[model samples]
Target chain A: MNRIVIGRYIPGNSFLYRMDPRTKLIAMILLMVSVFLIQSFIHMLVALLLVALLLVFGGISVKRVYLGLRPLVFLLIFTFLFQVLFNRQGDLLYSLELHYTVLNLSIAMALVIMWGFTKRFLRFRLLYFLATVAGVFLLFHYLPFGIVLGEGTFSVYEQGLSTAFFIMVRLVIIITLSTILTITTKPTDLNLGLESILRPLRILRINAEEIAMIIAISLRYIPTLLDEANKIMLAQASRGVDFQEGKLKDKVIQVVSLLVPMFIISFQRSDDLANAMETRSFVPGQKRTRLHILHWSGLDTTALAFTCAALIGVILLRVVGW
Target chain B: MNMIDIENLSFTYGGKVEALKNVSLCVKKGEWVTILGHNGSGKSTLAKLIVGLLKPQKGTIRVDGVELSERTVHDIRKKVGIVFQNPDNQFVGVTVRDDIAFGLENLRIPREEMIERIEHYAKRVDMYSYLNKEPQALSGGQKQRVAIAGILAMRTEVIIFDEATSMLDPDGRKRILSYMRKLRDDGVTVVTITHDMREAVQSDRIVVLKDGEILKADKSEDVLKDKETLEKSNLELLLPLEVLHGLEHKKSTNEEIKEFLWQLSLNG
Candidate 1:
């Protein structure tokens, strides 16, 4: 739980840290849009280079960026695999052949095989997933035991591989840039920055201040709630919840045990917080001042201008068939 | 002048459970009053009542000469602050500095003065260096200290601590109690709601609550002598206090009781 570092701010005095939050926020949006605009492999590589440069100039390490992407490793790999396997455009790269005789096996034997496969899959999920994909292709290419579907050929496409690679790169760039923004900016500054940027939405009958306050409060409580949930987990463990060593049914029970108490504790906490805020004279929609007033310095303007130029350049490149 | 005055305060939860019943108490300015009670006793309820967190069904609370009502509660809150139990839940800011600034921001203090008060109170609580640290990164005691600093930054005349040290370890609790003592010395009316007899003994006055009613209210020394009241409140006496009480029951002199406790400590 402690390893989950999303939306956490690390204090630093780097160039990114010194930039106004509004500048960074706007720059983040532009960078995010530009990442999706990446069309060719060369554009993806250039985007990666720009991201690395930003990380270096911002005094953030590559390992830190990798750490930010660590939690999404499984999802990224899953998406990559789905895109690679299902996509059938472009030249064939390789083919696989598989053989299995399900018709010859008895029902009991089939159940045993399925049980063994399940055990192995649970133990080594990622490896088992790759194996399953390979097994499917091999079965289509070689096996003719029960029924035949089509040409019975399983082939990989260059377009599939490239598309998968592009998507993975896009996801990594977006996540890493977001991580950089959050890591460099303080929560209060982020709140104020978002509030000021969204201040124009007041004309649309939106409560930007309240929305900002909600976001700020949620950010503030994320780590705190995580800590409380950790404590509750430990307490339940001490009471023999057996979370780590449990059957599927037992695990469900243990999870419910943890969640129920967490929900109760959080509700009680919100009540206390409401009272505390009220006692502190925090009225919703009231004009409130902040201790840290954001000042847009020369660095902020330059950063914003650079992001806008980069965004326009990307759009221009795409429009002019570069 | 009385900093907090409660008259016939009664509160019920869901019209069934009486949390506080006809609880009336007066705390003078600069007085360090500790409310002692066991679990489910009405002390926490009273603390909430004083801070205007909960409205009494039939009573009145006056803080610093301002009556506490729906209209006047905000004004009363300006003079009365509370640091509740569960240090994690009470902290409203992501960082220590921001937490201290929370109350100040609510009061609309200017940024310059907010900075000054955040620094001053954080230093007073010895949490100046940790101003940038997240609340979750700090120990329970450190968080409680930050909570106190947050309240102090508001410059409230009376600060009520609702079991603030109940969640802390011995060392942490001792550190917080020392801070509370410092706050008392600085002329802040400190109301501590706790069941720890040791903490109660350090206060200027101890009010024992039992079954949603006041069991005993007296000076710390006088209250410590009332074994019946302590027993009724289910508040355990310290080992030394227990020994002293045992010796006093046998009609021993103060010197003899002290000598006996001393010898017992040495022998043990």
Candidate 2:
């Protein structure tokens, strides 16, 4: 109940969890590009297959991965319907004769593309070499590979495939890697990493310590903030302030009420934190001790190596026009 | 050495509501002093002043013979740690251990030493098992314990409990008071701002506050026995202490008061 929807990390000791956060971050960027770069259905299908295999290797349960995606199911459906209706120029498979343009390739392509993009990868694994090749295959599958739109040569399938797949791929890549990083790294270690990584910013006179302190304080208050939100939600619900029971406007009003209290709580917490920090000798450049030590082990090195390999392999695949 | 000395201390919030006026007192090193004041009697304000959280408008505060000023506030803070009324609000760390580590981090102690200090203090406060638990999930008593551990972990000589036990249930209050006595016996200078005279009567000294001014400051025995002075401050004198004193004098006229006095004499 205290867990936040964002930055919610579950601690585990799998191979994915042990990777260096920086490596994970970079690999995610590469994976996103590869996922969207493929065009044909065969490529997408293969990509999904690769993702599934990685999910098994990464040791994250499929049930948990699916649960994470549950919240975005509506968005996925909306995107599919959007592509099917707005996409024109493909053979008109089914039209109700009432201001709706539905194309054959759009419907089948949307489902296959969605499935191709979602499988295995949602669970998060290291499959850079195969995934990129599969992505290229998917990229060429629906995009007017050997055909033209008869004259002007505008293929809806090609445009939709490139645009939709790229957008979905980017979104999935960011979300999955972030989840992977958060679930693996303890928050205190994450702060330390941020501090060490941003150390070079000292040359810019950016006051890295101050920025790191803000992030650490914000992270520390996560549970307290969640508790405040839940308390407001329950209090409002008891008073018949039913957000789900009302029209859009009423729901918005209810949400506003909840947000107002949450904001107030956050301000109060921050004030308390500021006072606490100041009293505890939290002066800039003050020497301090840490109770927890994060050790970079052999596992971390191996994970980093794997992540870097995946990233370079994906880029090479792209370079070679695979 | 006097742990803390306050002379003619006065404070106002926004130049309107006066929180404290002409408050003067002294707490010797290792003395357990209780400041008994009801709501708005300026007890907490005094605690804040001693810990350098609030600036005195018209007085001098000296901690360990060093005058408290803006330049010396940090030094005063290192000597005195305050546990605020709301344990939840006063805590800066997510977990009990982390919260204790917060102060150490600010002090910039080495990592190895910080871990040793945290465990030591957490054990003293009997919160060793809860080192990793979040403060919010703890009961009021447990939260207070964590708060104490956090302060004690810093190894400050003087500690101020500003209604630290008020949020607790009866049992929790009892446990905290017991721990406080233990701390006192261990030679830590403790300044507890409380309205609980039962606990106050057991302290080394008691300072009564009324209407933002010091009503009385004396040894607990003398202060607790001064019924007229206490009643004037809207604070009831402690029954047991009064009974024992009355019995010593054999001066009570009321039958119940007489009986209580008589029982005290017999017990003695």
Candidate 3:
């Protein structure tokens, strides 16, 4: 559950945290655009370094940034493999004959080996996945028990590696920068920033304020809904609904039981909330003043100016074909 | 002048279930009143009605001399604020300070004044240290205290606790009750909707509701002494109150009754 800290804000008074949310938001957008625009690995590395410096200045720990990236490990690995395997333009690093039957053993022995590997894979997924990938390549190189079905080769292209590395760095930096933004900015300020950024859409009759309110309420309710769902799950577990250990059918039933009650509770809660909001004079689409009026400080101005200058530099490099 | 005045209040749920029927009550300015009832006894409905959260089918509710209606609800709400039963559900903000500022924000209070009120009320509820803490991180009692602080920040003349302590433990309940006492002492009108006889005993007056109608409304001690009315409402006397009631024939003073209970506990 702690791993679901993507949208949760950690209160702080660091330079990045104290700068206006509008500045942070604009910087995030410019940095994200710059990350995608940088094609060369060196440029990507520079972008990553800039993000790293921002993280340092923001008082965010490397461990926290790494934890934020944990959920993306599989995506990173998948993209890396996709690039490595599919990009056939690369020069061959090694070649081998892939045999149809690598295991020259009795059925019982094969079943035992398969079972052992399956257990290990289930227990240590990431490590086992890497090990299995390595073992498959090793088997292709070394095994000579059966006839070869086809020629298999491992290749690493200069172009593919550079592209893959650039993509990976871009993704890591974007995610880290965005995480830092959310970690520093409070939800309410984020809502206000979004509203202000999108205020131009109001001329197109888009109701930006209402949209911002929706985002703000959704952000506020995420933790609350998670807590409620947790309580419902625990209650169902107490009633012998084994969510962790059960057949698919049993798990479905357990999920349904938890979800149904949660939906009902949420509906009731929304009703009460509507009444409460109404009593508190929260009229939809009506103009309301804020208690925390966002003011642009000199720090915000400097931060925005730096971000724009960096963005211009990235653009200049691209235009000049650096 | 009446802080809150209700005349023949009747409310139905979706025109089918009657939640309250022909109930009327009044609280004088700065008075402490407890509305006591069992579950499904219309106590919460009455509280909501007074706070203008629910419209009555037939009745007039006035808070600070302003009649409660759709047009006047916003103004009425300024005069009266309610702290609801579920602390988690009622909380609209992620953190304690944000929640306390919520009402003040709606009222359009200036940022500096909102901050001052937040600090003052948070300190009043002894939640100053946890002002930045998320509502989920707080205990049930702490959350309720934060809710109270939010309402207190509104600076409403009439404050309603609609089963606010029902979800809390004994210690939390005591802590909230003490706050209610403090509010009363500060000349704020307090109306606590509760089924807890112990809490009712501490109020200046008690209005007992049964089956959506007012069964009895009187001084707290008089209401506590009415065994028939208490039994009819399915309200039980607190243990000490029960003991005190048993010695009513002996005409014992409250201090003497307390002394006897202490001696009885010592003997045990």
DockQ of each: 0.62, 0.50, 0.47
- By DockQ rank, best first, the candidates go 1, 2, 3
Looking at candidate 2 chain A, the ten consecutive residues that score lowest on lDDT are: A95-104
DockQ of 1: 0.62
Report the lDDT tens digits of candidate 2 across residue range A161-238. 445555564455455555555666666666776776677998998876678778877776777677777888999989
User: Model 3: residues >4 Å from true position, as ranges?
Assistant: A11-14, A87-96, A102-124, A147-163, A207-209, A240-242, A245-251, B244-268
Residue-by-residue lDDT tens digits, candidate 1, B1-268: 9888889989999999998889899999999999999999988889888877788799888888888888888788888888888887778887899888888888999999999999999999899999989877899899889988988999999888889888999999999999889989999999999988888888999988999999889999888878788887777667777786767677477787777778767855
lDDT of 3 by residue, A1-322 (tens): 6478687688787897888888889989998898888876678777777788888877988887788898888999889778776666656654454444435223324544665558543866776667756676666566646644455566666656666777778889888988898899888788889999999998899999889877877787887888888888888778877777677898888888988988998898888777666656567777765766688999998888888888898889999998
Alpha-carbon TM-score of each model against the true structure: 0.88, 0.80, 0.88
Question: Which ten-residue region of model 1 chain B has the weakest summed lDDT?
Answer: B244-253
lDDT of 2 by residue, B72-143 (tens): 999888988888777677677767888888888888788888899889989988899998777667887888
Top-lDDT candidate index: 1
C-alpha positional error of residue A154 in candidate 3 after TM-score superposition, expressed in Å: 6.0
lDDT of 2 at A51: 65
Ranked by TM-score, the better of candidates 2 and 3 is 3
